[model samples]
Target: MESKEEHYSHDHIMESIRNLSENDAKTFLNLIYALLRDNTLPSEQLVSHVLSVYEKKIPRVVKTRQNK
Candidate 1:
């Protein structure tokens, strides 16, 4: 279970995000995307890992090391 302080922290962060102007939100997301793009890992493998962890299910078509 999440602690009260942790919940409040997430809530505060979300509230701050919600208060951003539309343009600011877009720019923030774009910057995050740029950082992700600059990583050494392949994008598809990163996506597969994220889905497997968060969704608790294997991706239908994960990339193999041999494919690289």
Candidate 2:
């Protein structure tokens, strides 16, 4: 079980990410990728790990916007 503080921290991080501009979000994601790459984790392993963690979260329909 997650502690209240941990839950709040997670929510805050997600909210912050959601509010980022598209370019900033892309840059943030690149930074995350660079950090993982620097740690010598293989891209395949990262993808597998992320998918497993995401699967454990609540399932929902992810809607993608069509770029005009």
Candidate 3:
């Protein structure tokens, strides 16, 4: 069983990942891929496929400020 500290650390790490910029997240994901490349991890492939599908489905939003 995970202790309170372990759970908190896991949640904190997940939140940090969620808050990362798009490019930063991609870099992080690639690092994870490299780490899991030794064994054929189904999860790695699943996440990559899911992200690719969503990327194709969702259009990117450009944030621009209007001139005052």
Candidate 4:
């Protein structure tokens, strides 16, 4: 049995992904494609979920007015 501490949580995985260089990212994506090809992952729904999570994390910009 694996303890929670032994598991790579979503945040840890995301942080690792964020640290990858472009070439590494390409290799990572190729592995994902292979997994998809072998039916190891869900198709478009996974992409949609990732995109939704990414979009929600973007910080909104607010404008401020200055008084003279």
Candidate 5:
């Protein structure tokens, strides 16, 4: 059986992908398409890669105060 730790890691990876830049996300999707032609692709890897890209670009800042 799959462990909860595995599940959580998978979920976190997907969340990172959701945070990816639009262009990066689209490019990864296209890569998936090209790579999966007549074959099975590992979605988790693709999603994780997308998220890794996001992690590089997304700042950790939660908020900024300017005119507030």
Candidate 6:
């Protein structure tokens, strides 16, 4: 079961998309679905985590592991 904060309504996501270019928004959506399919987290929770991870550590994650 997801905690209350992990869930987002369609309107909420649509609001976020409102400022995005159609091409950017489509790419964002494709990445969302990819995360949902690739990660083990629930679809709802995975979306939240994906946003969090992207906002935080995505660059570090993409950097060479050999550097660590």
TM-scores, each model vs. reference: 0.46, 0.42, 0.39, 0.43, 0.41, 0.42
Off by over 4 Å in 5: 1-8, 38-68
- Tens digits of lDDT, candidate 2, 1-68: 43322322455445544555677656556755666666566878877555433332211111122121
Against the true structure, candidate 2 has what lDDT?
0.45
- lDDT tens digits, residue span 1-68, model 1: 43322323444445555555577557666755655676666888767544332222111111121234
For model 6 the local lDDT of residue 30 reads 78
lDDT of 5 by residue, 29-48 (tens): 67656655634548887666
Q: How many backbone clashes are present in model 6?
A: 0
Which one is best on TM-score? 1
- Cα lDDT of candidate 3 equals 0.44
* Of 3 and 6, the candidate ranking higher by TM-score: 6
Better of 5 and 6 by lDDT: 6
- The models' CA-based lDDT, in order, is 0.44, 0.45, 0.44, 0.45, 0.47, 0.54
lDDT of 3 by residue, 20-61 (tens): 568756765675566556546587776765454234212121
Q: What is the C-alpha RMSD of each candidate to the true structure, in Å?
A: 15.9, 10.6, 12.3, 13.9, 9.7, 10.6
- Model 4: per-residue lDDT, tens digit, 1-68? 43323434467556655655577667656755655566644768767544433332211100011111
Q: Model 3 segments beyond 4 Å from truth?
A: 1-8, 38-68
Candidate 3 colliding pairs: none
Give the clash count for model 3: 0
Top of the candidates by lDDT = 6
Write candidate 6's Cα lDDT for 1-68 as tens digits: 43434534456444444545577557666776788778987768877777754442332322323245
- Cα error, residue 57 of model 4, in Å, equals 24
